[model samples]
Target: MKVPAPNDDRKGGRVPRWLRILLPAVLIVVWLALAGVGGPYFGRVSEVSSNDQASYLPASADATQVANLQAKFSGSDAVPAIVVYERSSGLTKDDLAAITDDTKDIADLPGVHGDVSPPIASKDGKAAEVFVPFADDSDLDTNVAGLRDHLSTSTPDGVTSYVTGPAGFTADLVAAFGGIDGILLAVALAAVFLILVVVYRSPLLPILVLATSMFGLCVALLVVWWLAKWGAVQLNGQVQGILFILVIGAATDYSLLYVSRYREALRDEQSRWRATWIAIRGAFGPIVASAGTVIVGLLCLLFSDLNSNKALGPVASIGIVFAFLAAMTLLPSLLLAFGRAAFWPVRPKFGSEHPQVVGPHAKGLWARVAGWIRRAPRIIWVVCTIALLLGATGVLQLKADGVPQSDLILGHSDARDGQQVLADHFPGGSGSPALVVGPASELQPMADVLLNHDGVSSVAVVAKDSPSGTAPVTADGVQPVGAPGSPPPEPTTVDGDVMLQATLSDPADSDAAEATVRSLRTDLYKVDDGILVGGVTAVAIDSNDASIHDRNTIIPIVLVVILLILMLLLRAILAPVILVLSVVVSFAASLGVSAYVFDHVFGFPGADPAVPLYGFVFLVALGIDYNIFLMTRVREETQLHGTRQGILRGLAVTGGVITSAGLVLASTFAALGVIPILFLAQIAFIVAFGVLVDTLIVRSLLVPALSYDIGRAIWWPSKLWRTDAAILASDSDPERLVEEQIDAIGAGGRPSHHHEHLHQGDREHPAP
Candidate 1:
């Protein structure tokens, strides 16, 4: 009496059927519980999220240091909202009286800091601007929205009121990201659902796949929310939106891969439990490798100097972790519970042929792809590589210096409009000033340095003795703003330092303003090394410079890190090198195409430097996933069949699944286009297009053809390089081995017992 092998017995035949059922039930219940808990955290994310520029700056940045020290000098951290009232004609008495009344009322509003600046007439007198300061702890967007409503009602007729400044811009930015938790996510899910329903052609299967993704996202969010709350990580609107899309796309892709394997296994295995186990074993390597690659690649962002970039690294990695977990555990459990019935109209039948596979031959579009690859491997790779290289030439057009804050929000923006009005009549940096902090004794010298700069329209020092918050400073010194006999107002000193606010002639968000601030800071630092420059313009300059530094520093590190991961996963130096190069080429091409689109089509302002950094992280990391999916299968199949045949078989078998995964990822990322922010939109296009390129061209044509041409040497330095022929011969003949194992199970006998019988018959009459 021979016992069946471990593989046969483990699939409910040996293990109790009750345990199998219980396991899936438990998993489903756990995931449902996790989803329930995480679903509510969406709205609560703002509790921990911040858009404060200083918070995201590098610690050592002069702006960051000044931001910290400047906070100590003030009672509260305040953002100024510049309210500009304009009319074609000079302001009438009624308009001036209305503006004065509005200022008084604004000072009483919640979150208002100090006194609202009395309406200061613009040089043209056609416009008057009021500066309203909002405290740091306030809900800035809410307060600004309320203020807008108030202005609409309080302002005199024929005078249009526009809010523009740091506070106004922040409100617009926050409002732009407002859709992330609702519309962005809903659209992404709906798109994925439609795609899944079409791909599986089964109502129940799509639900299971979506459930796995939703639950994965929920759990990942739950963890991230707490992590952010505890200050273990930082959360922002941009990062939050990416996290939701990335997790959903990644989980669904992993689920699809597993579903495909489970469906294939169901054709041979009699028991659902057995098929699920077999599917898990078959899918485990690629799923883990793919997720690991993405996780490690994202984590490479830790090297970034910008806190936002560094924060995204772990935040997104955590999302990937849960996505992998849900795909492996929750999805498998759902499929196991549903069994063959999950497919509904098109169920996988035991002992029936896999639909994509015809008797003794693979037949389909993928097969044709394989045939074409076999016909001209070198031509296919060379042509595809050159085309990608040509597309990559567009990388020269990418303008990643940085974008003005006014352009940060797409579509209508009152703040941006107000900035234009203010620039037309008043010093462009009317409400927002570049702040300089230095030794109290050096205040006069720092103020002199600021006054002498070409960019400086005026300079003032905070003076405690003045009724107004500040006293004007000329090249000579701080000029008293009081009555003639009053002693010169003393500059307010905090610790040993005094603050000077420099007004710029250019718009605070303009490149000219940044250049001016850069020069002023350079000159002031020479006068007093302790002098620190910060404010809206300085923050922008510093942030952009840091982002550029991060882009340069982190891109190479990410590349090196991902290359090493590929090397370990493939266990071949040459293949990893080739894959890294392929993805880098693919990324460049995607960026090139995006640059053209942004310039000629979208007419977008130059990209933020971080845009390319983010694109590289997502494209290369995610791009390598498809290659991993294909090459791992090739490596697996190569162990059974020779390398050349293995490449063909691997491409044919994995084509539909990998392509579907790529489409799903692309679609989800494309959903980000709905958000209307430049950075996310650019990223959405680059990564989505890059994935398709990898799926259609690189993975389908280039990688397989190149690998086929290289043959077994693709696995160079691996022991398989020397032992390929022997491994191919003694792999128990994969086709015969499967038949023998099935027969042994049917006979209730050991695989050893039926091995010779199957081998002898296979030798006598081989498969086509």
Candidate 2:
């Protein structure tokens, strides 16, 4: 199949030599300035990013309510770090003495709150647990490190110590995300560069592509940082990491499309200026359509109930915007400056035969695929659909309800280790408790309900007059720790409200604790509708529930939105429906594969509910990108060639470039695995694998075959249906006739290019 010629009129007429040179120079300088200004914000993202779980909860969530009231109860926001000292042989007198000394030292550390609870020895006599409240404003990682250093230096010789709890976990999480700036970016860029070098087989071309992508990311970061700083959006490590990879991957993908068009154009036009303009016009529609689909789908996250998911929508959309801008402007300018040399050793010469020639028929790999489709379009789509349906059965195995907070981070976690020790000795939820806030007059009633649950180990109400700031509440009433008949201190009250803390029998992050918190809320809400139950367990429950809500709400919205976008872009209802179905099937298959791998191979406890939501948004939005690329070209080709011939021509022309773009995107997302976060790793694998599926099977085989079997009806309700322009354009050329015969034989002995009668409208004027 021969590529269509570039008309000077279609590209806004010929560009003058001086303007071409001057335009590229201005673009280069502007992009370099953007990169220079935004580069320094890389390592400093943490200044605006947060990892706090409660901070991401929905405003209406019980945990969010309790967290907001925490200052009223405690006078300051504090994160508790539980320090556990253990000995296999059981605790000795010296060990007990050393534990006391360690507590005092811990209290003296910077960022450590003044109220350090005395070390409480476990009944088993093998372990001691101490609660150290760290001010929320402190540098968590630094404080945790300092505490660890102090304990290691001052603890008894035979005893071991670990820093764990909300604070410890938060510190570990912060440290994990710390890799995003340096290691994650390095790996993603390195992978993209290497892939580009191999794909294009040119060093200079890869460098140029990398520069465009990096510039996009740098400028995107600059804009997003100020937005985050100004409170227009929330920034978190997960969102930040995703933004980086998305920009680089997306920018490169768009660049690949433009570069493919440029190289193809270079062969047809002698002047680089004309070639660049033609390439830009040809590449513009598909690139913009592709980016628009992704951006709209991501924006659907705004409907999500969870703050984290909501925040990600605009954050990622901003990245995609920059990616689109860079590809359309920066990449085109750079390519124009270098012209044919951009491809270097494999540069295309003007008027050279299309480089991928195979025999006199021009039957390349994609041509072969088209021929295979033509032979049995029905059977090809049927078999592929059946296989995909079978693979989708594994979705039943997907455990996306939630995973424990401790498991959120992949490798070793001192907090996780300490939780186990704490559970083996003291109440699992000692330092972190399920807090209940209600009217001050009803504090005892709430405390009694908590005490009634088997999961509740103890209950305490905040008492301002007590030395420990809290007094125990038993079944009878508030119990004084002082002499008998002495008056029990009044429970602390703020705005006629009081807080009650219930220590649990299970670890704060465990499922049992979450269940307990749920049950407590159910019981307490019956007593008083305004009562709030929250803390570590409540945060987990609320976060998981919100994620589930988001998955249900946002997934459907994203699909509907993308479906509409596809319909508008393709200008056909039936085609958009089919494309949406194909992508949905592809997404299900990807999730199914992930489910089996996570359950059997990785032995992951489960997945975050948001995982499927994120996977759906990315896969369907991104997976449909290849279809957009293919079908738009197919539609364009159909306008010139007949529908049947256009399907083949479009598939043949687009196959290599689309596949390269998919592989590039897949590799970039796969780079997310290097961060060692379970959420990122799952997303990395799902998106990477799904993109390849879209490229290799869905876009290449199923969509094409289905469209071919359906014929011009694929453009239903559009004027292109029932029209054939191939004869009017090339019927007089003898070489075209010979090529048609060759293509017919290549396509399963099908009859060569038979023109159809034009549709009812404009039979006198053939399609241009």
Alpha-carbon local distance difference test for all models: 0.85, 0.85
After superposition on all C-alphas, the RMSD of every candidate to the true structure, in Å, is: 5.2, 4.8
What TM-score fits each model? 0.93, 0.93
Q: In model 2, where is the ten-residue run with the lowest total lDDT? A: 759-768
What TM-score does model 1 achieve against the real structure? Answer: 0.93
User: What residue runs in model 2 are displaced by over 4 Å at the alpha carbon?
Assistant: 1-17, 355-360, 482-486, 724-768
Alpha carbon lDDT of residue 703, candidate 1? 88
Give lDDT tens digits, candidate 2, residues 1-768: 655455333343455667778998999999999989999999678777888875578878989989999877887788878899999999999888878876777788989976888888999999988888898853877888889888878988989899998899999888888889988889988988888888899989999999999999999999999999899999988999899999998999999888888888887778777887878998899999999999999999998888989999999999999999999999999988888888989988876756322213455588688778867889999999998988899999999988888898899988888888988889888878999999988877888899889999999998878878889999889989677888898888889999998999999889899889889999999889999888989988998899998998888888899989988998888889999999999999999988888888888888989999999999998899999999998887667555766676678788888998888899989989988789999999889988998999999999999988887677777666634433234223222444566677787875434322222111221111
**Model 2 error, position 413 (Å):** 0.4
